[model samples]
Each structure stands twice: as C-alpha cells, then as structure tokens.
Target: MSIFLIFALSKINYARTLIYIFHLATIPAIFAGAALTATSIGITGKVLAEIGKLSAKEGQIIIGAAVLDDILGIIVLAVVASLVKTGEVQISKVIYLVISSSAFVVGAILIGRFLSPFYVQLVNSMKTRGQLLLVSLIFAFILAYIAQVIQLEAILGSFAAGLVLAETEKRSELAEQVFPIADLFVPIFFVCVGAKTDLSVLNPAIPSNREGLVLAAFLIVVAILGKVVTGLAVFSKEKLNRLAIGVGMIPRGEVGLVFAGVGAASGALSPATDAAIIMMVISTTFIAPPLLRLVFKEPTGSPQSVSSEQ
Candidate 1:
C-alpha cells in the first residue's frame, strides 16, 4: 500500500525524487528493509508477546487487522512489479492480480465453510496433537507452493491456508500445536531484519554526520505519513478505538521489508536508500504504541472501561 504511494510520488519526481534519481540508493534500501521485514522478529513478536494482556477481543481483531495489512502489502508489490515490467499499465494484470487475490480469499472462505469442519473432526479424533502438526505444516506448504505455481505470492497462499484454519473449531489448538515452529523460525526472520540494518552508520560515532540525521528525519516523515492514512481504512464505530486500531495496525514489519529486500537485490534500490526506508519502518513501529495508547478510550460496551463500577 505504501509502496503504491512511493511509486506514485516517485513518478512525480517530487516527495521521493531522491529515490528515483539515484536508483543506486534504492538497491540496498530495499534488501535491508526486507531483511528487517522477513527476518526481524518484528511487531509479530510484540503482538504475540502481548497475548492475554489485551482482551481476547484485542488479540483477534488486532491480528486480523495486521493480516489485512500484510495481504495489502503483497498486492501492492505485485501490482507495482507488473506496472514496472510491462510498461503499459496493463489493466489486464491489475484485473488479474485483483481477481487472483479475490479467488484466494474466496477459496479460503470455502475452505472454512466446508473443508475446515472436516479438519475439525480429524483433529478432534487425534489421539495426540503431534499428527496435526505434521498434517498442518504439510498442508500449509502445499498450499503455499500451489500459490507460487499459480503465479501468486506464496505468503498469500500460506496466509489463506492459515485464515481458513483460523476459523475452524480447533483454531486455538492448531495455533498452540504449531507455536514451537513459529517461535524458532519466526525470530530468525525478525533478527535477519535487524541484521540488515547497520545502525552503526546512524551512530554519531560513525556515519552520524548531520546530513544522515537530516535524511533520517525526512525518511521518518515518509514512513509515518505513509501508514497513517491506512487508519482511514477502518470505518467502524463498534468495539475498538478505530484510530487506535488503525495505529496498532501500522507496523510494516515483515512484508514491507521483504519488498525492500527484493528491490535491492534486483538493483532497484541502493544501500543508503534501503537504510532510509528501514528508518521509516522503525519510526512508524516506534510511534505505534504511544499513538495507539493516546487514542485509546474504552469503546461503548467495551468490557472494562464502560462497564466498570464507577
């Protein structure tokens, strides 16, 4: 979603002309950002770690919003890539990507509607939870591969599989059974994200020149503003604080960084540029909690605030 904005602003030779004019800069910026995204145990760790403290209401809705952002990020990258590659603004590809994505969404709904109940029965019948692990992992991988084979994003495939499984009778059990794997591999993903960022450059001890700070400031604005608008995506007045909900959903985490990584490796961005984008991510994530908390007021009918004994 932000990438679409970036691509658009870059076209105007305005906001991000720094990025477009020096294609070299975008190279490393993209990878470093990706490494931070896919590799960093980012906001995922934060969200997971916050389990139980927030309402069950909090966990489910927050996670759903994040997943929405994740899916949107993937679509943004695919659409941008198509635009760049074809040079024709192929309306056909835009249609295809949307149709394909919708198909995945529809397919997942069907799985939940039909296939998941069968899975519920199967999981229920298991003697030990171990077999569910094997079966689920295999299923997820197969679906992911199928998505890739179909010229769709693998994460989309995997996410679709997860979403379907999420709505099943045994959603809680399934998440619990596989958390071991999620814990191990997931952190590496986050750390790898951190690994890509050489913060040393930002240190006053090194590349910490005034210019770097100035540039970092600019990037911060870009990053923060980029996601702030996404809050508008929420039009609901029920349950959660819409602004907080939107703020909570702002962290770019894995997918944004992954796009940066791809762009860099493919010579789309330079190292310094990649670092700038990473800074943007950091600012946005860092800003999320405070902003969210600021906007947080227990909604009408909220479990705690409105119902509390005054």
Candidate 2:
C-alpha cells in the first residue's frame, strides 16, 4: 500500500504541483504518500474500547495489525530520513537499512526476552520509589540511543522495548506509569511540529495556496480509499466485520504527524506539501472514529451466532 501510494501520488500532476514549485523534486510527494500508511493504534484502540469491541476478534486483529503497521512505518521513516540526509537513493544503503532495521528489532526482542526475568526480579527487589518506572525508562532510553547510534529511528527501539516489557508481569503497572509521561511529552511534540509548520500554505484566499488545498483534498481521498480497501484482505469462512476492521485502521493520528514532522524538518517537503500531508493526517484522524462506530453498529449477525460460526 505504501509503495502503491508513493507511485500513484507521484504520478499525479496535481499532487506534484507544490513539489515542482518548491522542491523541484519528487521526494515530498513520496513523503506525502508514505505518511498515509500510518495507523494510530492509540486512537484505534480507544475507539474499539468505546464501541465495546476491544476484546472482540476483529478489534484484536486490527490492534495487532496496527502495531505491525507502526513498526514498518517507523522503518520506512528511517529510510526516508536517510535519503533526505544523503540526497540520493543508493540500493546498497537501502538494502543495508532494511537488513539492519529488521535485525535491530528482532535482536532487541530476543535479547530483551532473555533479560526480562532478571529485569522483573531487579525491579521487584528495588524498595526505592518509582524504581520500576525509572528502570523501564532507562532500558528504553538505552535501546533508543543504540538505535540512534546505528542510524535507525529511536522510536523503533522504544517500541521494541515496549514489546519486550509487555510480556512481563508488570505490564499494567508500567503502562500506568507511562501514561503521565506520554501526556506531558506528546503535547509538547505536537506543539513543536505546529510551531515549525507553515500554515500559510493552507490559506485558500491566496491563488498559489489553492494548489495546496487541492493537493490536500487529493490526499484525503487517497488516504480514505487506501485504508478502506484493506478490509477486503480478511479471508475467512465465517463472516467478520471487514469494514469495521478497515475503518479501524484508517486513523493516522500522531503517527502520520511524525512523518510530516520529519519531512518538514529534513527540508524534503515544501511548505505546501507539508501542509497537505498535515491536512491529510488531520482529516483521517477525525473521520475514522465515527466511521468505525457506524460500521460496527451495522447488523451483521448476533455475537452468539458469529462465535458459533467461527
């Protein structure tokens, strides 16, 4: 889907207008398309909980798929960030990135798994306040620093740390401790992105800005259709709420914003292109939750019958 979006959006003249005007290159278009591939597990999970489907099979599937999507998206972001830094695409570098990224994630999980029992034991033995939280943060930061040293995204390492620690007995407690940290830092991150973004490109009153508006509209359509079609991939003898699954995957949320932020910061994206990507993210994030609720609200069969059929 990411590849298709990159190719398809790049080929469209409207989508490339801002890119041609500012960057005189296709990388911004690529960023725009790549940004579309992100699905926010945070938003999706919340919606699933709201609709009383978080524990349901479809909900579980979407959540798991979103996690995979995020991991892959982070890898893609790393590759794109590298491309921006080097200003060229080298197949050898790309291959190396792919291999190293996979290895970093897999290696981290394996090593962390082996060490997790000790990790749990150490935390349990600590009588100091906030010991578990501090240890977890230290572990995550170490992995994140290692990722940076290895030229991969730090978020990937943090995410890998999360996966490993989630298997431990303190998963719930760790999550509780992390919530306040996320609440504090996440908003600051968004605020920084907003401060850096040139919102003037989105103004329709300006003639040139109209192109960006058009580009944003195009992206919004592609973003919606791109994710909605993913629902059809579920192949099973028993019926499932495939539409719900797809809709659940549609919100780009903070993940999409991260792509846009990286693109803008790297100077790979023009103001118009960056604005368009941001608009696409905002549109998808807002649109998906209600659509998901509506889709799941539809009559597909009783839960009992569906379970029996499964």
Candidate 3:
C-alpha cells in the first residue's frame, strides 16, 4: 500500500513537484514507503498497558502483529539498504536478500533453541559477576557479526538472538539485566538520529522548507491509513475491537527513527526527505497514545472486555 502510494504519486505532477520542490528521489521515496510500514512495539505496548488493555485479547493480537511487523520491516530494510548500496534494484539481488534474511532469522532461532540449554548450564556454572549478561551480550554480538558478514543488518541478528534467548528459563532474569543496557544505548541511538537529521527543513519560514512540511503531511496520512486498514484484514468470528487493534499499530517510535537514520547515513535521502521522515516519526509516536485511549474507551459500568468471544 505504501509503495503503491509513493510510486503512484511519483508518476503524477506531484512527483515532479516533489522532485523540484522537495528534492525527493525515487529511491528515497521508496525508502520512505518502507519506513512507513513500521509499527513500534515499545510505544504500542506501553500505551496498551497504560490504557489497562495490555492483557486483553486486542492487546495480545496487536503485540503479536507488531512483532511480525518489525521482523518483516527489518527484512524490507535489508532489501532497501542493498538498493541504496548498489544504486539500482536487481530482481535477483532482491530475491537473494529476501530468502537469505528469512532463512538467517529462522535458522538462528532454531539453532539457538537447541543451544540454549547449554547456554543456561554455562551461566549456571559461572561464579563471576554479570556472567549471564556478559554471555548474553557475547551471543548477541556473535550473531550480529555473522549477520554483518552475510550482508544483512546487525539488528536483524540481534533480534533473532533476542528471540532465541526469550525461550530460555532465564528469560525474565535476562530481561531484567538487559533493560539497563537498553536504557543506556537506546538514548544514544536516538541522539545520533537527532544529530543527523536536518531540522531546518521543517521550518515554514523558509519557502524551500515548506515542501518538506507538505511531504511530511503526506507521509503521516499514508503511515496512519496503511496500518489502520490492517484491522480489516483480521478474519475472525469473535467480536473484537478491530479499530483498537489497528490504532495500536500506529506509532512508529524508535523503529521508524532507525529507518530514517539508516537512510540518512547511507546518503540515499535528501535533507528534505530526511526531515520529512523525522517529522512523520514524531507525529505518529505522539498521536498514538491519545488515539489509543480514545479508541479503547469503555462504558463506565461495563467490564473492560476486548472481545465478545472472550
């Protein structure tokens, strides 16, 4: 849907306007499309919890769908990154990337599942401080390095490592330790993203900047509509809050920033395009919490039920 919207706009006078006004190129436009497809599990999950719906059926479905969305988004990121690297799309290369990325994630999880018992035993035998954390980081980095060697994103490997570790007995303990590390690194990551983004393009005072603002608006609309429609795709006999499910998938949050950062660092995105993406990210992230609260509203005396079938 996003790709079609981008490409369709590119063929019209709007495309020419984008090129002349916003300096958006075909590749960056497509990159923007891919970026639009992301749903931030972090923000969405937090919002669901805040609204007292985190354990509800709608929340569970949204969480599961968001996880799948991130994985698929990562795969799309790999393919898009390759396009940025080579400067042209090769059907064969795309095919290889799609296959290799899917296989790598699946294989890593399967192999890691088998190895997790030994990993647990190894940690159990260790008397050193932070042994579990240290070993887990090592495992994650090893997979990350392997992913880099395979020409895929290191984050993909890290994600797969996380999936593997999540299945272990020490999952809760590991998460407790990992949170501090995530706290330390996640800010730095966002800092880098903010530093790389040229915010001047978003200013309305400058005539040239207006184009980017307009582009950002277009992207925001596409981003919201694209995910909102996913609710309709739910095929179920239960009377579920499909609107809540769709709204839950709205926030782009950190994941969207990663895409923007990658595009900026790769030099695929023009300054205007980069700014537009950043704006889209911020807008979606902020809007989702309130929108979610509104959509999940229940009657004062009624039970907080997510589905009639529940």
Provide the clashing-pair count of each candidate structure.
25, 0, 0
lDDT of 3 by residue, 211-282 (tens): 788999988876787667766456678888888888888899988898898888888898888889889999
Off by over 4 Å in 2: 1-24, 301-310
Instruction: Predict model 2's lDDT versus the native.
Output: 0.80
Quote each prediction's TM-score: 0.66, 0.86, 0.88
Give the per-residue lDDT of model 2 (tens digit) for 1-310.
5423432343344335535654446567657767877889988898777667888988987887787777777777776776677888688987898788878888988998899899999999999999999999999999888988888777778878888888888999999999999999999999998888888999999998987888889788878876777665666566778888888988999999999998998888889988888889988999998898778767554565334432
Candidate 1 weakest lDDT stretch, 10 residues: 32-41
- lDDT, residue 14, model 1: 27
The per-residue C-alpha lDDT of model 2 at residue 189 equals: 96
Top TM-score model: 3
lDDT of each: 0.55, 0.80, 0.80
Candidate 1 residue-wise lDDT, 162-195, digit = tens: 7777777667877897788888987897688678
Which candidate do you rate higher for lDDT, 1 or 3? Answer: 3
Ranking by lDDT: 3, 2, 1
Model 2: per-residue Cα lDDT at residue 201: 90
RMSD of 3: 4.8
